[model samples]
Target chain A: MSLDPQIAEKLLSEMRRGAIVLAVLGQLQREHYGYSLRKNLVDRGLHVEEGTLYPLIRRLEKQGLLTSEWREEDKRRKRFYRLSTDGREIYAQLMHDWQLLNTSIQKTTGRSE
Target chain B: MEIVDSYLIEIGQHLPEDSRQDILAELKVTLEEEIGDRAAQAGVEPDVQHAQAVLQRFGHPLKVASEYRPVRYLIGPDLYPAFLHTLRVLLTIAAVGVVVVSLVAAFAEGWQVGVWSLIDVGVSLLFWILVVTTGVFVAIEYSGERLGWYESWQPRRLASGSLGIIDRGDVMTNLVTEGVFLLWWNNVLVLPNVINGDSGSFVFNLGQVWAAYFWPFNVLVGACFVLHLYVLMKGVWQRPSLVLEIACNTALVAVLIVLVTSPEIVVVANETAGDQSEFLTNLVDRTLRISLLVISGFCVWDMWSAWRHFKGASWRRSSAA
Candidate 1:
């Protein structure tokens, strides 16, 4: 069976929310500010929008899942965000969820072979 | 330097007052740092134009403005779908309410309940449905589903750099225009400024007692609106503590009823002119009066909700400890 390109794209976009959060958590194990974080994620081929990234950063901070502080770097203060203690716990759980999801997907797709 | 400074100011103008200077400082530092790097790469001396270009590459005023803003959803993400569902339910209920009331009124009048009655019922139903649906859509679209809608939705979040710095100049102008129309059509300006005291006016009006003449009243009204705008921008009003919200809303309804119904009974004779019926005019007058009262009531509710949000944040912090 074949899917229309637009439909497939929309479906992929809709399912990417969880993937984005997981990616953010994994990357934020090391502190990175907004632009650098975006660049790192994109460098890894994960495309996140600036509009999406800033808000997500704030939300993660507010939820106590991420800790952030502004520090002077090369004459400019940049807000560096990293995983909080709670965020570490959350990251671990999310990693478990991801592995389960990944295995389930692999099993279903593998069965087709 | 001039161009970079102006651009930074423009960006700062869109940020919350508390964080405006800090953000501007950061932006300046960022521009300087980035432009220095770019100039080094190009082997050209760093200049104003070069910094401007780099800032331009970063994004425009609106784009940069948005980065510092809380996530806004029309119906807000967390409870918007639920709000939409509830709105549908409310509209259905309001439609049924209008029909039943109109029917009862028609039958009580001992009329045969003719075509005009049917038309009246239809118009009432259509009017409320249109109103409720438009309101729900606006609330949802402006405040609804978004990833960070809830993060800055609290009342104190009104002071947050992201949601707070929004320049509502365009909206304020529009509101002033609407307010002028409301004042003119209602003959509200003609009413005396005296609060619950008699003035040498031709007629005593109940609306005059609770009129929006006083500055404090205006301030309270303005605060309610600001709170509403804060909620709309932050997108938390949709999924706020369900019980607390419902109770606040119910209290508003009760206040509105009292404000409206009181004028009808208390200041009956003063509600009319020679040919004009006091009861009818008073009913219309009181409705508007009650709406203002309810608005102020909601402001008080916003205060409560703000306290709750602060408590929740504090609780979270303490529990983590």
Candidate 2:
């Protein structure tokens, strides 16, 4: 039987939320403004909504995982963001955990390389 | 630019006051970039339509703003069930109390008057109690989860909140008993005929010990009345409410202990034959002693029951987080 779309969407979003932080953090290793960051992630096949991305950025900043500053770019003011020292350490740990979990899942599903 | 500015303002209005300007500035820059991108892709100016399209893609302003705010939980999932149960229990007690009062009034007046009173009293009492209960739960919710005992045993994990509801029938019995006692205690129901002889000289009267303890009894009985009303609605025993039950029971038992130990709990003032008066005094004293002792025993049992209800409640998660 097919799963209901709403239920399926909810489950999918929960999984996506788990990975969204990693995706955002990985991109934030290089300094990029908010708009450019969104575009860059979208180009890389990770589509995050404008609304969802801002709060995450602010939360990460508040948690001391990101640092941001406003500066003039292309004749207009823009807020650029990048990872702080703590963010780099956290991102590295998370990447290691993800890889291990991914490997286990692959083996369990008989899709191991 | 005007369209984007207006859109940003609209979104900003719904956001938190502290972060409004910072968030709005970021939003504006992002929207401008998005509109510019769309305009370039289609070979057009970054106009109103482009801004509109970008805004639509972002979704509703309120919802977007909401994502940034701390999640609003007046009574979060943790206490929502108990809140609802408490509300239902209180409403039920109010309705029952109203019906009883209205029925008594109806016998004296008319059926229409009784029905009107039932509706009026039921509506007003329910409304006030609902407000009071909701306010209390809201306070508890915002009270920052400081209750060590509340979460000590995984209250939220219990799918069906251990209402520790002994039974609905038992609650009704307690509710009715408390209602009658409150009326009798307040002198709304004169029991002089039952306790006194035809001459009105006291055959059986409460001793001097009760003079100081009147309001204490009212307060304790009222506390238990509310507790039972809550228990009836909850249908299971939870921690904080059960703690209240235990407290009320202990206080009641304490008062009963004092009353039973008193030398003259019920002074028979009849100056008839010495033997008869003495016999009457002994009978009344024995009866009072026995009754209070029995009630004290029940109170102890209630305290034990309240404790046992959640004694086995274990921590479902290692970390509450």
Candidate 3:
């Protein structure tokens, strides 16, 4: 069946919100600055845009799910970010809930996981 | 790099002040890094085009800045319906008002002059009304004093008579009316050379008596313009304004008396007329006189009704006190 592109994209975007947050948190576990983080996400087959990444990280930081500090890297100062202690615990629970939800959906839809 | 500089400057304007520099600094790094990556992928050195491409991907300055800030509406949803209704009524009236004024202009001057009048009245009316409406709404939104508006319920108000409060729509109408009249009197619009009719048209000029009241008319219109402007800004009529309104009406009555009583209101110059000059002049003069008489009646009636309304408003206030 054919679907309208705008509706399809909008559906995908709504679905991506939690996934994007998870990706950012999971990726930030490995200490990357804004550009490197965005690059890594794009490289990982996730379609994160340039405008979407920084604000998400800042919001995550405000929510106590991320920590950042400015330090030198490759002879340039960059704000490197990683999951905070609370962030690590929260991410673990979120991952657990995410996996459970995923398994439930797959079972309910009769899709092979 | 200039493109990047301009982009950052634009973004900085819209960013929240407390975190502006930090946001700009981080954005700058990401932008420059993105450009370098694109350049590397394309096997070229980073340049202005690379910066331009990166900034373009990041989107408009306001869009980018908005992402970092909490969303806000200038006129929030609570007030939106009222705002929309106000705009609808005002703009509809304005559209009709400008066409009517332009028709009057076309009758007095030429059709080309009427077109100019249309454009002049349209721009001034629509632009100022929108600005004033938006400004007023924005002020209300920011003040937050209107929190009561959300809680207040008055079903009776929907069916009640006039509350004597000034209607913003009426104020806007008066403001635009006075403004357009001022523009017409000042000869702000250029007049094109009108082609005379097949039989040729008469050049009708008012007699010296009318010419003598030129500045007086100008000053009179100017004062009315200023008074209405003041009333619009204040959003209510105080005793002083009511007095000023009566004074302006009194002066307008005197001017109308002089204009209508004049023996030679519109005389056709024979040099500019065809063979049927006398007949055309008489026809034109009578029309002019009739128009003046109609206008005088309208003005006097308007003044009378307004004074009566204000007098009622005064009694209401004093009795309430």
Candidate 4:
């Protein structure tokens, strides 16, 4: 069945919203500032909007899942962020849950490999 | 450079003061970096146009600043439904009050002047109702104190389904009527053509009785307005609102009694009339008395009904417990 363009777009957005948190947490294992982190995500095929990415980073930092610091590099100051201990623990738990769900879905669809 | 500085300044205007400097500093660096990248990709040195393009891509200053700030509202979601309810109630009251006033004026005078007065009063009531209701809600939202009533809400009350939901339409009608009446009482509205005679135009003005207790009259109306708003906000009629309603109704009843008993509660004067003046004055006086009686009846009914609702709520709470 053909999906409406609006419906397809909505579905894509909803799917991306769920995945983006995991993608952000995974990428934040190493230190990267807002702009560069956005670039890394885009290069890895997740084209997160700058507006969306920046706000999410700030929210995560506020939730104590990430720690940020300001440093000067190449004549410019940027706020770099990385996974805190809590964030690392959360990332592991989320990954495990994701794998279990993935396996369940695959088995139900008879697409297990 | 100046364009970037101006852009930062624009964003800074919307941001909260404590974090404005830090957010702007970070945004400035990011925008400049984006401009540089755009310049390299386009094979040209970055200029004001490039900076502008980057800022445009970043989005409007308000939108950008809003994302940085925690979500805020003039009337947040928790109170929005109540605000809407209160607004509807007030508007309905204004409409009914305007219709009644128009009919009375039309009966006393000519239909032409009455129709014009109706339109004028209707428009003014609507405008003031909107302004006052919005102002009240904005004040409540900004107060930021989650009122004790909200905090004390019990799940059993919801489950019991016995909570008195104030009739949305009645509440709205009362609020608007009270608001419009307050405006009229305060001399914000003066109807010159409400009463007319063969000799000349006559104006029906509130007599010295109301003028004597002017501040108290305002306080009574103001209290009623606040009580209606509180009920509408709470959604379920709570004990505190009931107490306030009864108090305001009692005050209104007293005021109405004093007004009706007082000599010449409404005075009518014609600019060019001689013998016909007494007839017009008596007519106006009788009309004022009748209006006061009708309002007084409503006040007593309101007080009785509020008392019943308050008692019913308490009984329900006890039963549920």
The weakest ten consecutive residues by lDDT in model 1 chain A span: A49-58
The residue pairs found clashing in candidate 3 are: none
Residue-by-residue lDDT tens digits, candidate 3, B114-232: 44656776789889999999899899888874736546867764523342445566556655665556555545433432226567755666676777876887677657656765655
Quantify all predictions' global Cα lDDT against the true fold: 0.60, 0.78, 0.76, 0.79
> Candidate 4 on A40-90: residue-level lDDT in tens?
998999998777778788888989999999999987888999999999999
Cα distance off (Å), candidate 4, residue A56:
3.2
Model 1 ranges off by over 4 Å: A1-17, A42-47, A111-113, B1-32, B46-60, B72-121, B129-321
Q: Over the stretch B1-321, how does candidate 4's per-residue lDDT look in tens digits?
A: 999898889889998898788788878888888899999999999998899888888888888878888887988998887787678767755665554554455456634333366467678888999999888988988988553566787887662333488876677668777766664654444445455557666666677666678789777887887678666655677667778889989988988898888887776644455667777778778987999899999999989988889788788879979
List of chain B TM-scores, one per candidate: 0.37, 0.48, 0.52, 0.52
Task: Estimate the lDDT of model 2.
Answer: 0.78
Residue lDDT tens for model 1, B221-276: 33333443344334443334323334544554555455555543224335224434
Candidate 2 regions off by >4 Å?
A107-110, B92-113, B146-150, B154-321
**Recovery fraction of native interface contacts for candidate 2:** 0.77
Angstrom error of the Cα, residue B114, model 4: value is 3.3
Give each prediction's root-mean-square deviation over alpha carbons.
21.1, 14.5, 13.7, 12.1
The docking category that best describes candidate 2 is: medium
Q: What is the TM-score of chain A alone in each candidate?
A: 0.90, 0.96, 0.93, 0.93
Lowest lDDT block of 10, candidate 1 chain B: B193-202
Residue B302 in candidate 2, Cα distance off native in Å: 28
Clashes of each: 17, 7, 0, 3
Q: Select the stronger candidate by lDDT from 1 and 3.
A: 3
